[model samples]
Target: MPKNGAPTRTRILDAAEALVIDHGYAATSVDDVIAASASSKGAFFHHFASKQALADALVERYVAADLEMLDSGLAAARAAGPDPAVRAVAFLDHFVGLADGLMGEQSGCLYAAVLTERQLLTSQTSAPIATAIRAWRDGFAALLREALPAGSPIDVDDLADHVFVTFEGAFLLARSTEDPSHLRRQLGVLRALVETALAAGPQEERR
Candidate 1:
């Protein structure tokens, strides 16, 4: 194993994630990662027990990064104000900034990459990915609760799910059209949707 074990492990993971996102999990071999990272098999095994272990580590790292983004972005966005409309606008605006930063890198969703070759993955990898995605959903739902008109008729869970839908849809369209700005453009529309929902107001109290 190399003396720079941590850097070597990170190098392998970085190379593997890129390959998996581009070519998929099944197609990316251990030797491919070793060569891509410019590390030997000794360094590889010193870090990971096997190829599957490497995949698990990749999923864990990806999920951890995503959750950090989710939490931090929501905090910054919600800091806009106490008003629901203001919060909604702030959230979307923050997301647009996020989208702009992530534009050309839209094809690199680790969850999407893992699912694209799910049969080759273990439950250890799949379960955490699902949980992380749901964390995204639930986190957005919390934002919606703060942003939407209290007691509005809209299903908060369903509305929250649309956040992911819009992102995934935007990513696909961007890829097909080679339009880098598509995501930012679509996220801009989400503010209007929230505003409309906010104005809808609470329904008549159930007797």
Candidate 2:
């Protein structure tokens, strides 16, 4: 425990994630993390054997949090409405509400940060990220399937990827421009897209 830090590992990861977001993983160093975390070198090495290990832990923590968010947002959607279409909109809406806080608290996504520096992480670290992202795709696809009418021409997976891209891009755009509203507005667009699909039933599309 050093300087208002008792939960040493979480502190390290929090600081590391911030550094990784602010600067690429290749550019960030263990000393930077130790300083940011207000942790000692002994505490840093105690939790992580090496910088690579810290990277691995960072990925795992971010991935787990992503999954939790996906699941909880889905839960919120279900609770918000009974209809699948409404639920679909609710799902995106849930994130829209959180978008500002996300923008304010952490202006960038760790996943996107790591992704641009793919070479920085080992396969073991990268695989979970890929899997978690695909999990988001699958989760959203399942929800979209329930929301869309039969014979819908839309490929849920593609639509799902669009959601992913918007979410990632929103954070980056917001961070770059120093605009929290950018995140909110981008997420609003996603909600509108879901509503559009839900409103246009499969039969209507054939017209």
Candidate 3:
């Protein structure tokens, strides 16, 4: 579709995604995307209606990729262990490792960023971001449901929500403090939670 006969749309979205990851949504610009993607205005307009539309596309792509990685990691973790509780812990540990590796000393979360940057665009632009966040939360809940012991009475949905909030906060803290140990402690807390849940045995339910 581009006059240059390039993969302009993908190039633009990919460029936007990378820039948003590094500089964040509010801080990035169309010019930056153009420069990074090496596309002309004609090509950019051909793909996206506006900067907000491009951002929406980028966020959707980012969320999809992220969910895939999380799903894969959780699957790998479950596959690595026999006990359901152990598998859950392993999955949480893998998630922690992923957070450390991806963000490192960088500040901010992609989801948190989208939520925060929603003010920059109109209400219509917010739907996709909100949907992405909800999907992520639901995905986590589903993982917990799968990792729970057979006949366990624990509300997997609630537990997953708690875990998601805790994990998100821990990542934020680690980034803010530049201290990885904070995240380690948080992950330890999650492990302890899983251990406690498992301790309830086959007959007990979450309190």
Output the number of the TM-score-best candidate. Answer: 2
Top lDDT model:
2
The digit string of per-residue lDDT tens for model 2 on 90-193 reads 88888888887877788688888787775755456777888988988988888898988787788889998876898888887887788878877987988888
Q: Model 2 clash pairs?
A: none
Q: Please state the error at residue 197 of candidate 2 in Å.
A: 1.2
Candidate 3 lDDT over 69-186, as tens digits, reads 7677668666877765566677777766665665554444566666667554454655665565566567666666666667777787677666557756876787678776666577
* Per-model TM-score versus the true fold: 0.87, 0.92, 0.70
Report every candidate's CA lDDT.
Answer: 0.80, 0.84, 0.70
Error of 2 at 74 (Å): 0.9
Candidate 1 lDDT, tens digit per residue, 4-65?
56688898998899888777898899999998888999989999999889989999898898
Ranking by lDDT: 2, 1, 3
Residue 49 alpha-carbon offset, candidate 2, angstroms: 0.9
TM-score ranking, high to low? 2, 1, 3
Q: Which 10 consecutive residues of model 3 have the lowest summed lDDT?
A: 100-109
Q: In model 2, what lDDT does residue 31 have?
A: 97
Per-candidate Cα RMSD to the true structure, in Å, reads 3.3, 2.0, 4.9
Report the candidate with higher lDDT, 1 versus 2.
Answer: 2
Candidate 1, residue 41: the lDDT equals 97
lDDT of 1: 0.80
